[model samples]
Target: MHMLKKIGFYIVAKFVPLLVIMLTTYFFSRWLTPSQYGQYSLVISIASGLSIIAFQWINVTLGRLIPKSSADVKIKIINSGLILYFISSILVLFLCFIFGEFIEDNFKTSSYLIALLAVALGGFELSQRIFNSEERVLAFGIFQGIRGVVFFSFALCFYYTEYIYPGVVYALIASYILLSTPNIYKLLFLRKKDFIPNSIKEIAVFGFPLILTYVLLYVLNSSSKILLTVMLDETYTGYFSLGSDTVQMIIISVMGVVQLAIYPIVIGAYNKNDEDRYNIFSKSNQWVLLILLPVTAGFIGISKGLFYFLLPEEAYLRVIPIVPFLIIANLFVQLKSLIFDYAFHISKKNGKQFLPVFCGAFTSVALNVMLIDGYGLEGSAFSYCIGCFVYMTMSYLIGRKIFKYPSIDVGFLFKVTVSSLLMLLIVIQIPNDSIFQFVISIVVGALSYIALITTMFYPQLKKYINSNN
Candidate 1:
């Protein structure tokens, strides 16, 4: 029942908002030109990417610190993070003014736009980090939903009013305000005793690697835009950004469900020194692969049709060839994030596990620099995908060395990979004649995956299921 409530709550809280954003995006894209939409995406991405420095390790610290921290210390940590963020925001604002016009001239992201994004981003981290620590994940989820609605509502007004740029900017700024609303209550009501800040240094030390990891992740993930801006134009950047946002909405909405549940549970077990419960996480590695593999395969299989069907015709025509590779890269990227969170937040690997992430980030930058000149956004996509693979592999190796967990069943992974490939082949054969066919193909592919897992891989999962039962 608890599980059901959690799943239900999160589904509504997370996916509902995501759907709102997706729907809004669909309509917004229709109303706005591709270049206009892409410009919005670029600004947001750049703002988000740049704000990484301001956040430092606060998000990571909250997850680990909250479980172990007393209330007083938590408050201090929150306050300090907030204080630090504001300071960073001011510095970013100054930098933006200095280079904002240059970027606007080159990248189509204006100075005013950069400054607004910087402010929104700074406030966003504080609110988001706080909710994350309290495990009021429902609130966190609702925050995202509200932000989307508010922003979309604002955007709608602006788009219709013919103030395209300002409307969009207002929407972003408004979302940040709305998202930060709940945090005010948190700030006012939560007591000094209910939070902890004494462990600031340790928290920072512990979160250092994750800070580096996530920053690189931002760079790695957003490189497509950066490359697009350089290789193509703001117009092309807009297109890639739209598709990328849609993909992210899908991937994050799905992945967020698992992560929200996994974190509190893992932390609870760790706090209690429950090895058995801690070991439950090992099973997650398998479960995530089982779930993600076929989804990735399906996306890759139906790349052309899916792109055409979901996005605008312009995007559909331009983005088809690149979507599959991008989705594939995104899948691995999602998994790597999961692992990083589990290692840093749940398993309490201190800061050491971040070594791979650093290496992966460095590799990603090098790859992007080398590849983007030759291949453009496609090159960036390939680099990111490869980067995710490298990061996941390294995280696994480092995690094992630190935690000494047993290896996952390689045989099972191989079998699932094979099953996914087979299912993909079958899915590809189905002629996409209509919506019905698409729906049927999806159902068939899903069932095929289930059948393969249950029939061929049942023994492996059965043990885990029975154990839990």
Candidate 2:
């Protein structure tokens, strides 16, 4: 497939699941109280943190190894990965059971079942990454879309039946199970093979350091919620989570697609020592910033009005103030993790990848501990943004020294920034008292951006767009 078409497919595939989740969250905000929503958010955060700790290295390993392996070697890697996953899943479950009380006390919920579901979710996630590494974009998308559909349908059912919290959890568990079916078939039934010790050792060597990397990232992302839950209450945590989720929706909608689409290509290009690798890397960053900057601005501009329609009035008031900070934080995160961090991965400097995130995570936790008590929600937002900035700066410096990819064009970046600012100016002027007005304002802002980009940078944009064609 053409690179652009592949990216488009991956984007559509990724976008469906995100869109479903977004809709689900919108309805969830309306139906559940802040406290109820907070509990659910806590469950999700804990589950995600635990899952990442347990299985993310395996995912990262597969992502690195699969694309570069031969057909026979790929099967061996898959078999080895399955063995590792089984062992890791068992260990994780046992640890969770041991620490069940501590988790329950900290998050203020029964966590044993959630932990079990998290192991399953981790397996499904690992499966998704394997598919991604193999360039099975369509299959990956289908699995994600199915999971989204199932979760949304079951969540709605549970809500109407008045079993909201348990319903959501059950829905997630069910979707994960369904998603894992194809993976099970691929590993156990279709390509059944013995576990190779050498393969296991190789994957472990490559993947183990990534455990620390992912754990630090989890801390950077989730420490705010954990701290808020401890310092104040689940209600505040809920508000904070809503703010993060709002920005995350934007990140996944664009950055997530780009990251997924480009990573394998970048890996292949590096492996073959392709001359155009720098061009691909630079263009990816340029396009990502071009779309991401304006979207972030529009979201910040429309946050109050958007939340007014999407969230309960009380929840809206609590969350709206923190949205812009969270948006900025996520922007830094996307640029750091999705764009600049590629250099580290491609260069096989996996250990070097640890420092920037560790610093950010440390900064985030320290600031959250010191600031949340005095400044409350705003403090968490501020701490997060500062940490993200620290991470991005470090990653950019390190990436430049190590790989030396071409920088994004100054003229192009200026044009994108100016166009986005113009869009923001027009968007902020539209009265957003109602949903219709909000929708129209977003459309106008987007069209204005498109118009400006087309007029101002038409030649460059046209050449870049046609390059892959």
Winning candidate number (TM-score)? 2
- Residue-by-residue lDDT tens digits, candidate 2, 1-469: 3556767887777777777766776888877777777888888787888888788888888877888888878877887888788788889878778777565475534567577788878889888877777778677777788888988888889888878876788888888988887656655553334556888898889888888888888898889998999999988988888778866875666666667767766777776544688777776777678777887888877877877876877888888888888989988987776678778877888888788888899999999999999999999999999988988888888788888767778888898889888888999999999888988998998899899889888887689889969
- The TM-score of predicted model 1 comes to 0.83
Clashing pairs in 2: none
Tens-place lDDT per residue, model 1, 1-469, is 4644665666666776767766776776677787787777777886787667556466666666666667766667676555445556678778778775566465444666767776777677678667766777787877787788888888888876768875787788878967766555555565556534555566567656666656776776677677677767777777777667777777777767766656666566555454675566666666667767887897777666555566788777766666776787788677766654465445566566557667667677778788877887677667777877787778877766656453568888898899999899989998775767887888888888778777776786689789998
Question: Candidate 1: RMSD over Cα atoms?
Answer: 3.8
In order of appearance, the predictions have TM-scores of 0.83, 0.90
Residue 183 deviation, candidate 2, in Å?
1.9
Superposed by TM-score, candidate 1 places the C-alpha of residue 113 at a distance from the truth, in angstroms, of 2.4
How far out, in Å, is residue 74 in model 2?
A: 2.7
Instruction: Tell me how candidate 1 scores on lDDT.
Output: 0.70
What is the Å distance of residue 153 in model 2 from its true position? 3.1
